[model samples]
Target: MLLFSRFAPNVLLSAAVALSVILAAVMLGLAMDQRWLGLKLEAQPRLAIPASFEGLWIDAIEHDSPAAEQPGAGIPASVASLVSIGGPDQRSIQLTPQDLMEEPDALETYAGMRAFFARQDEIAGILRSIGGVELGVAFLGETQTYSVSPKHQRPVTSLPPSFWMQIGVGLAGFWLGAWIWSLRRGEWATRFLLLAGAGLMISAFPAAVYSTRELALPGRLFSVLSTFNHIGALTFGVGMIGLFLVYPRRLVSPNWLAFPAVILGAWQVVDILQLADGPGLGFHLAVVLAMLAIVVLVAIQFKVTRGHPRDRAALAWLGLAVVVGAGAFVATVIAPNVLGIGAFVSQGEAFLFFLLVYVGVALGVARYRLFQLDEWAFRILFYVVGVLLLLVLDAILIVTIVDERAPAFALSLLIVALAWLPLRDMLARLVLRRAELSRGNLFRQVMDVALTPPGRDQQARWRALLENAFRPLSVTAAADVQDPALIDDGLALAVPGAGGLPGYRLDYADGGRKLFSLRDAELAVELTTMLANALESREAYEKGVAEERERIARDIHDNIGVQLMGALHSRGLARKDMMIRETLTDLRDIINNASNPDLSFDEMLADLRSQISEHLFAAGVKMKWEVESAGPAILPLAAAHTVRSVVREAVQNALKHGQPKSIRVTVRLDEDAIALTVADDGSGFDPSSVQTGNGLANMQARVTSLGGRFNVASGVEGTRIEARFPVDIVRITQ
Candidate 1:
């Protein structure tokens, strides 16, 4: 029900109504038949004297037969006078043997004549004397005798069961199609349903014309029905054409065709009304014009599908329907009338055209996504043929069973059952296999790898697995080598035997490899390079740890040495005991703070400053400090300590030899670089003369090794030292 509502509500309603009407019609027909049966006892054969047969032969012929002297016996002059031929108001008519010379015309006229005689046999004597065949003749003087065959039976004119069935089917089909159309709102569905309904109404018009003459409908009703039919046909044509334009797969101009379509539709309706009484030249003209429009539409459809391959299948289906429908329409209109095959055949042909059109339209609208229509068609054909074969077999079985050949029927059934399952399975498997193949091999391989577990030593394992897997493709791969080493060694070795031809190498190893022509050699080189790098890195890490430990020991011994010795010197006396204890505490604190990894570079610098100030105050050297930084002070603790040591050494040098009155230390950051300068106003010495004795060379060497610039400019006025390093370098070391 939902499906019907969704896709074809109009169709559903039409089918329902058609079914009800069919049931009513069937019941009514049955009741009529029963009533007819009940009236059989009193019923007599109905016959009529044709009004046209009055004066032709009845006037001249006499008695029931022609006389010897006359070819047709003349009517008795007295009786003819009394009869007044065809009564006073009737026009005189004549019959001649010339009219009866043609067998077909004579037979038709004779049949009418016989019907007249049967209804009024009392006047048969006059009719026989005129044109009808005589049953007997009286002899008087020169008498003649004649005989006649019994009259042909008139055919029963009631509608056949098949005719009713056809009407029902057509009504149901049209209603179903209309209901489908009605699911859509407003003009679109209404117009289509109107068109379909008009077609059905038009179809019933001929039956109504055939069935009744006295109760003929008013001319206006017929005119309106005709107009509606013409309009509906026009609407259908225009709608289909509009659909072609609006939803085309390529360029289309609906506006270009719309005005003309409307004009053509109106013109067609006028033409139909004008020609409704009989076939006219105007009807032919309208048909020609409609054909031209159909041609133009088809041409446009072809143009739309030219560049759009996606629409090709749909266009093909539509084109086929159009061709078939048009052919059928043409055949229906011309074949029976021109060839004399009768009317029902033409109607059947028209019905076929309509059916084809419905199927095509339904497929185009609802099943267009099935682009493989040809495949579907083939499958349907195959199944239909298969089913037909099964039916044939089933029929044979039934016939055989009825004839007592049970073994034959059983054998046939067995054969069919045995074949069906395997055949269906084979077809399914073939389709699936083709689909799988179309997806490509590489995708399958990737899927396989994804579904598998990672191995221990996953990197090497995966590389080896890929290499082995790809071996079937003649691809040689190295899994664990660096690129440069592959270029330097692997390529040279791999290419020597191949006369210097280069080869391609895929680099899947840790650091990858250079291209190699020979796959085997590249794999070996890659693996070797990976192992070498790994071992080298491990060794370097171990060496760095040992060096760090030694450096820490050296720093501890150097910084704390003088303070420890001073404490040891004062250990024996009570007067020096307090000094010794204080010295020991300071030394221990410095050592412990220096060893702490978590201490930030700025905190270390502050500690260093405090230690230096304590030492300087103890030594009686006045210190002036100035520090300016643009951003954070981010020097590492180790580098900060080194800077402090350098500062202390400079101050000590100034105090010991230069007799400096005031010592100054300034730290400033400029851009990313830091500059630290220590200067004193004291008796200064020439830096060239001081040489390495002043530890200037040591300070310069320490700064140079750390990628910093250190300079000591000492003259007679004062000694100045400046050291500069990158903040990034300091942080990295920390």
Candidate 2:
């Protein structure tokens, strides 16, 4: 337990910690999701005039006579109202529901309202030809109710793609942060990155609610969203700046971080006090200045780490991240707002740009080990440029020949195959003139080190191999690397030692044009791993010689030494010859066991019984051997050897020291443990009376070393020595 505790905490804890912080940020920004801003306006039902039916009428009536002689005077006055006198008796009038319903107060009930317009079409047609002159007729019904009020425009309630994009980007930032944190093994720089991601996600709430510009958001809510957005912007800027300052190189003191905080806070103060012509513009300017500072910091890092390819590469990657992420946001969001120009793309599209920054940063730190900077950078440039070209071409086609999507997509793909591929390849060749080593070839080179002769300078050879594969400016041994480390971003990869071998530091100085990227770092790691294996092999070879010598010395001292000592003090040649033969047999057993260590309990006990029973029989002592194991218990080579030796020594003691007439050896398994006992019908001596000797101490040490108990319980009736050892069933099986 103590040994396990010595290692660093689990990597999963990074994700757990990051998730807690992000979720807290989410809850803090929850009101934004509830549409506290004026960005969300709801539509209410209202009456509207129907312009389509405005001037058109069913029929016109010409009634030149006075009201007493008007046409259809036979009908009720309310129905007759559909005909009316106009201009003079010679003129035609278009009297419809509009005229009748105009005097709604004249009718008392809902039925009268319905009846007024019911026969307007027929009444108007009947009255149309009454006058000599014909007039156009029309019926204007009551105003119609529409779902939306024409007086107020409302944002669509259904989720828009832009809103979803904001949501996805926000959530993606948080999840990506957690994932990066988990993978980073708790690097402090990654922690800042995680914070940046959380802030981005929190700010997404406001972005989502305000995606549609036409929405009429509430004033107070808008102010709150604006504040939240500024906070998010500040957080992201701080994170990015901190990452630049500390990562790849810690050029500035941590105290420099306070500058952005104070600046942003002051800007926020101005915004809150409404001191600026544009309320949020000051905060945005502060954020922009902070971002510009980050760029300068990265450039400074690049300059400082000029000769260090890995660090330079990391700074270079950060530069790209900033340009792609911040540039996209500026072009899409900030510039339009500042210039009062329409945005070409929605702010949601900026999420992709943000993702690019994260991906670039991740590559700079984690991926640098995997790829060669030159080749990887060339490929990325080619692919991105080609894709952009294709998009431009497709867009051209959209505005020209192809107005629909399907045909445009097909044509774009066709153009990509014919033009993009050729262009990308040409660009790649122009940029990356040198050919890279294939993965398989590199692996083979690493493998060849193992086959090198022992006398050769394997360490130097491995170093040379890495130098060639990675093209590092310098390679030196670092305090035996135990794991892969990113030194100055991807400028150097510190590979830990393998199998107790010394580790090496890889340094790359490729000038300013090229820096070690993720792909390069990955290949370096492979080479380092290969080097580690070679070192371990050399270490194992040297250690094996020492271990073998120790084993021989211990074996001689324990078994042969004691047997020879006993023979020297014995009385007869027969006993001496017997001891010598036993010694020879023990020597053979040691050699055999050395080659095959996994000796099971049942097999070792059977051999122990065989060897001891013969010795007891020769000594004119009856031998009763009883061995039982509940399951196939496999003991380690050393443990099995100790068990056999302890049992053998006990039987010998009973016959040689106690002069026992009969001996009984018993072995049994109990649950996850095993027990061994030797009993004899001999006169027993008090253990306290006998002084502790090398043989007795050795036996006790062996049992105790295996985490087992060893004891001798003796009485006059019989003497018994017992040893018990624990076994892990699952561990043995595995």
Sequence-dependent TM-score of model 1: 0.31
My TM-score estimates for the predictions, one after another, are 0.31, 0.44
Count of residue pairs whose backbone atoms collide, per candidate: 19, 33
Using alpha carbons, what is the TM-score of model 2? Answer: 0.44
In model 2, where is the ten-residue run with the lowest total lDDT?
Answer: 36-45
How many clashes (backbone atoms < 3 Å, residues ≥3 apart in a chain or on different chains) does model 2 have?
33
For candidate 1, write residues 421-521 as lDDT tens digits.
Answer: 47755664453221222224433433343333334343343344345422322334433322423332221222110111112243322222211223335
Looking at candidate 1, the ten consecutive residues that score lowest on lDDT are: 34-43
Which candidate gets the maximum lDDT versus the true structure? Answer: 2
Task: Report each candidate's C-alpha RMSD, comma-separated, in the order given.
Answer: 25.3, 21.6
- The alpha-carbon deviation from the true structure for residue 713 of candidate 1, after best TM-score superposition, in angstroms, is 60
Runs in model 1 deviating more than 4 A are 1-158, 161-169, 172-176, 179-239, 247-261, 268-278, 334-344, 365-367, 370-734
